[model samples]
Target: MLTIEQATYDAIVAHAKRDHPDEACGIVAGPEGSDRPERFVEMVNAAGSPTFYEFDSTDLLHLYQEMDRADEEPVVIYHSHTATEAYPSRTDIGLAMEPNAHYVLVSTREHGNNDGPVEFRSYRIVEGEVTEEPVSVVDAFPR
Candidate 1:
């Protein structure tokens, strides 16, 4: 199962809410350990609609450089689903680059109306094949 901290989950939800009516994409950065996954918002260029999502290479390059400087690699890649369910679309499978990296999806269907309750899930895309896994969001900070 994929694990995430409260902050990371909050960030992703905020990003998805910010990009409502369209898809938002980003990357999750963290150490190899499973303590706290530091998720970052990479630029996502909408395919002129909510049905499609394309990562902005220009922004991705900047993120890559930042990660390189930090001596860290991308642990997971994230994108939001505006209209459809939080499942891997055909295009998502086609654009799978790192099979090892977790593919995170935020579902804004019926739930995420406006700052709504969003569902988070993780997936693995290898060799044009999609394998989904469960995600558990643990609150890093106990109240």
Candidate 2:
């Protein structure tokens, strides 16, 4: 399972909508835990299209430094699909670098005016297979 904060979730959604007509990508930062994972957004980049995602290495380096300073290793890499479901594409399957790291995809389809079902989903890309995982986002304040 993967746990993400509500603010981070909103950020991802916003990024997705903002970059609609193209794909949006970013890094998910937080301390990894068995449950109640504390995750947040580190950066956002615009991917060219459904076929390719361009991650700025400099941005990644910056995120790495920040994570290192916070003693938090990157546990997830997230992106969005503007016209499809929250599932890994062929390119995504081919580019799965960290098998253990969580892969999150936000589907912006049907999300006109930013008022669509929160299509936040998690997966693990291992050996070309994208395995779905459970995910939850914590509110800003505990209920």
Candidate 3:
């Protein structure tokens, strides 16, 4: 299961909604080896396609360097799907390089910028295999 704070979840949903029609992509970084997602880092979708999402290479490189300097690792990698369900596509599965990161997919098909519920789901994609996971949203992580 993927446990997340409500604010983090809301931020991700908002980003997805804001980038509707063009997939939004981002990552939440936390201390290396820590599964907790504590920092939100919205990214540019280089593909900028309704059906596909890709992190800009330059931005990705910079993010990696920054994370390294901060002793952080991406705990959650997320993207939005404008017209499909919150499931990983073949390409997405193929691009799963972070075996330890939670892959999140948010679908804005139902509402499409309207004030309606969206499909937010999480998964584990490792070695081309996709496994859907449960998500638990909490006000905050207990101290």
23-116 per-residue lDDT for model 3 (tens digits): 9999999889879999999999998889898899999999999999999999999999999999999999999999999999999999987798
lDDT of 1 at 118: 85
TM per candidate comes to: 0.86, 0.80, 0.97
Error of 1 at 139 (Å): 2.0
Ranking by TM-score: 3, 1, 2
The top-ranked prediction according to TM-score is 3
Residue 110 displacement (Å), model 1 = 1.0
User: What would the per-residue lDDT of candidate 1 be over residues 30-131, giving only the tens digit for each residue?
Assistant: 654433357565566646468888876677888888877876677778888987888988889888887668899988876554855887889888998888
Off by over 4 Å in 1: 32-36, 46-48, 112-115, 141-143
Q: Kindly give the number of clashing pairs for every candidate.
A: 0, 0, 0
Q: What order do candidates take by lDDT, descending?
A: 3, 1, 2
Candidate 2 lDDT, 2-87, residue by residue in tens: 77778777877787777776778877655644333355564545356754577877877777888788877667788878777889
Candidate 2 segments whose C-alpha is farther than 4 A from its true place:
32-39, 42-47, 112-114, 140-143
Candidate 2 residue pairs in clash (backbone atoms < 3 Å): none
lDDT of 2 at 41: 60
